[model samples]
Each structure stands twice: as C-alpha cells, then as structure tokens.
Target chain A: MVEVATILLMGVFAALAIHSNVLRLAIIYLAVFSLLAAFLYLLYAAPELAIAEAVIGSGLVTLLYLAALKRNRVYTIGVVNEQQRDHLSDSYISHVERSKALREIRQFFLLREFEVQIVFVSSALDEALNDPAYDLIVAEDGEGFAAFTDDESYAMLELEMMVQMHGSGSAIRFVRHSEEGVV
Target chain B: MSDTNVGSESTILRLIVGLLYPFMLLFGFYVILNGHYTPGGGFQGGSVLASLFVARYVVYPVEDTDTEVLHAIQRVFLSLILIAPTVLLFTGLVARFPHYRGLYLTTMDVLIGVQVGFGLGVAVLRFAFFQGVGKTWRL
Candidate 1:
C-alpha cells in the first residue's frame, strides 16, 4: 500500500513538474518527485541507493537547477508615474496595478522565456529613467503607454510588433533611449 | 536585485541551519568511518558531507572562493584512494595481514568519502559562483 501511494505521488509530481508554467515551481516539483523516488528506493530495501537519491537527486540537483535559473537573467521593467512629486500616490499605484498594458508587457516578456520583474518607482520619471538597471521604463501617457528602452535591444522590436498584432495599436509607444545618457 | 545579498534573509532559517550544521558533519564522518558494517558507504557519506556545503550556501549565499582548493583536495584524495588499494593488493600487504582487512576497508572508505565530498562540494560552489557572476568562469 505504501509503495503504491509513493508511486502514485511520484507520477503526480512528475506531471506537475512538466505542466508547471513557472520554471522555479517546476524545479520544486522535480525535487519533490525525486524525494518520492528516494522513499520508494527505501521501501524496496535499497538503503544505499535511497540515501544517494535523497542527497544528490533531491538536494544537489535542485540547487543546480536553481543556480541555472538564477544565471538566466531577469527582464526588469520599472513603472514610474509622470508628474509625481514626493512618493507615489495610492491612486497611481492602483491604476498601474490594474493597467492592461502592464499585463500585456509582462505576458510579452514571459512568452520570450524571460522572468519578468516589475519594479514600482516612487521617484521622479527622469531620475528613474537614468537607472541602467531597468531593462525598460514604462510610464503612462494619456490614454497610451510610453515604454523607454535601450535603442540597441532587439527584444523591444519584437515587443513593439507583438503590441501592434494585439491591436493595442499605438497604445504602447516605444521610445528608444540613447545609450550615452545611461552610463 | 535590490537586495544584494542572495543569502537567506530569514533569521529562523539561518539559526536552524546553524544548529544542524555540526551534527551533519558528525553524521557524515560517522557514516564514512563505520561504512564497512553499515548500509551507507563512501559515496553516501560523502554526499552527506557535500550537502553540508549546500546547506551552508543556502543559509549564507556567499560565493565560496576556495573552489580551487577544494578541487586540489579532491584530486589529492582521489589519487590516494587509487594508490591505497593498488598498494595494498600489489604489495601483498592484505594477504600478509589478513586480520588488517577491516582496517584496509575503513581506510579506503575514508579516502573515497573525502574525495567524493570535496568533488561534489566544489561542483555546487562553482555553480553558485557562476550564478552570481552570470558569466563563464574559467578554472
């Protein structure tokens, strides 16, 4: 009965690992799968193999996957409100939170296999714009969105096209920020 | 990226890992030493020791800069592991001192355990360092 349950759980986690959309969650699922495999090894009276699996399979391998994911660079997008003095107001924060353009931008980056990190900046637009840490700076412009990005970045070209295809037509205007001002 | 330190910020996690660290080392050593009669042998114990390094990295995600030193130690122990068995068998030492066979097994197990531990530890540390620099690290 114990072996049957372990086997079933192992299959479940394996399926979860494959089906998980987020890479980090997939890694965790894989680790849990290995943990179940180790338990099954122990039930089969293979203590030696069980110990090895628990350590290398679950522990070391999970860490290796995490390290690899960490090496994969994240696409950081900073959202700054235009004409904001002092801290970001609650209204602007909620508006950006509910913005459809922001969601589309996140989806665009996610489809390209880049981890999307949205940073909310309370500082002035010009101050946040100079920070080279941000891959793209998104600011609300009337009814549309203004996206400031490095002119050399090819990903921005693809994103611009994606926006157009979605018929978000001119809703997201790409502004090529000069490299000279960044450093 | 805002938080520069990749090490865990949770105080409870740090404290728990800190408490468990020494016992883990002790257990690894115990397994390696008693491997001749126990279910765990060199490989298992060695990986346990390697996990200690992994746990340390988890609690404090600092780049272990001594990967070269670990590599050196692993190579030296590996050479010793290879040499010890050859020396025992070819020299007819094992044949002469049949009673010392247990001693020979323990010695080999310890040697193998040290080699495997250092090797795997270096692999994990190098992976972590690669993650930090986000560049190809030579050596």
Candidate 2:
C-alpha cells in the first residue's frame, strides 16, 4: 500500500511538472516528484540512494534551475505603425518586406539566445513610446523606419547593426533616449 | 522581481530558521560521523550540511559566503581523502592499527563529507550571488 501511494503521487507530480505553465510551479512539482522517488527508494531498502535523491535532486537542482532562469532575463520589443489606412489592398511586395524585416529582427535576437517578445501596437508611435512598458519601440517614420530605446538598453546596438545590414535598402534610424529624457 | 526577497523579510521564517539551524548542523555531523554504523554516509551527510546554508539563505537573502575559504577547505579535505589511505598503506598502519578497516572507512567518510559539503556550498553561493533567483519572461 505504501509503495502504491508513492508511485501514485510520483505520477501526479510528474504530470504536473510537464503541464504547468508557470516555471517556478513546475520546478516545485519536479521537487515533489523527486521526493516521492526518494520515498520509493526507501521502500526498496535503498536508504542511501533515497537520502541522496531527497537532498540533491529536490534541493540543489531546484536552486540551480531558479538561478539560471533569473540570469536569462526577458527582452520586450514594441512595434508600432503610423501609416494612414487606405481602401486600396495591401501590395504583396510591401507585406513580404514587412514580414521579412520582423523575421530578421527576431532571428538576430534568437541567435544570441535572448528571450525576445515582440508586441504589435496599432496606436500612434508617440503614445507607444510614452507608455514606458516596452524595452524597444520600432515605428514607421516617414520614408523609412525608426527605433526608439532608452540608454539602459545596451543590447539595442546589436539590433541597430542587424537592421542596417538586413533592412532591404530601407533607411533605418536609431534614436537613443537619455536617462533624464522622455521615455 | 519585487517579491524576490520576501523570504528574508518574513519574521516567522527568520525565527524558525534561527531555532532549527544548530540542530540541523548537529544532525548533519551526526550522520557523517556514524556512516559506518548507519545507512547515511559521506554524500548524504554532506548534502545535509549544504542544506544548512540553503535554509540560512531562505531567512536571509544575502551573500556572505567566502569562496576563497570554502575552496581551500575543499582542497584540503580532498587531499586528505587521497593521501590518508596511501599513507596508512605505506606506513603499515593498516595492519598494525586495531580495527584499521573501520578507522580508515570512518576517516575517509569524514573527509569526503567535508569536501562535498564545502564544494556544494560554494556552488550554491556562486549561483545565488552571480545568477540570482526567479524567472523573467518577456518579448
């Protein structure tokens, strides 16, 4: 009966560890799974292995994973557009160009293994820039494109270089906001 | 991010950790010393010892570990683990000493426990200080 309970609990925690969306909760579930596995080891009369599992598996591994998660911080990019709406259908070439630019931007960050999130905003570029929530703001400016960022976003230098090289002949301008300037 | 240091700020947790800290260390050393007569041994006891620091961090999220000292202690213990048996064998102490097998095993176990304990403590301290804790998911 004890063995059966341990196996049952292990199964439950294992499933939860896989299905949970929250990383921290999933880590906790994995720890619980290790704890149940330790109990199972004890039932089989392997007390030495049980103690090792309970200590290293549940404790040390969880701490290590948390530390790694913390180190890899997220990067948010907000894309805003100011083009006036027209009844004319969008051209295929323009659509492809826009998608290609976005894809290149994403790939540039992905190659560096930075977690990148791109949020599309239909609002005015100034409103989006004033929101203060986005790490980088990309907007349609006159004949080309402009990217806005604060002084703290040193990673934007790489993005600036990527846009210059791969932006399909379109002029790309980077505007760096000072610490005391408007966000 | 704001709540990352919440554990250290809780009075109840601080009190609990303070009360249990000494007992935990006592139990860890007990396991290490009694390895020959018990199921727990060097690795298990060492893990317990490492957990003492983990518990301390829970109540006080601060980096107070001296990596230089820990590294030195770990090296010394590891050297002892390697050299002790060789010295005993060369000096014919294994044959001359009473219950030499038990003595050698216990001494090796203690050395291993100290080595593993300090090594793991250093790893935990490095992670906490350099990498930190929690996750940040953004786009």
- Among all candidates shown, the one with the greatest DockQ: 2
**Best model per TM-score:** 2
What is the lDDT of every predicted structure here? Answer: 0.82, 0.76
lDDT (10s digit) by residue, model 2, range A31-130? 9899999999999999999988998999888887776666664567776766642222357235524664556666766766567777666577667777
Name model 2 segments beyond 4 Å from true: A74-103, A106-113, A116-183, B1-8, B89-92, B131-139
Tell me the interface RMSD of every candidate, in Å: 7.0, 5.3
What is the TM-score (0 to 1) of candidate 1? 0.66
True contacts kept of 1: 0.74
Give me the runs in candidate 1 sitting further than 4 Å from their true place.
A73-183, B1-3, B6-8, B131-139
Question: Residue by residue across B32-137, what tens digits does model 1's lDDT show?
Answer: 9999898898999999999999998888777645799999999999889889888897889999999999999899889989999999999998877664332333
Q: Residues A1-183, candidate 1: write the lDDT tens digits.
A: 999999999999999999875779999999999999999999999988998999999999999999778766577788876666456678977777677788888777655556787888777677888877777889876656788767577788778877888884445777776745532
CAPRI classification of candidate 2 = acceptable
Could you report the DockQ of all the candidates, in the order they appear? 0.28, 0.29
Candidate 2 CA-lDDT value: 0.76
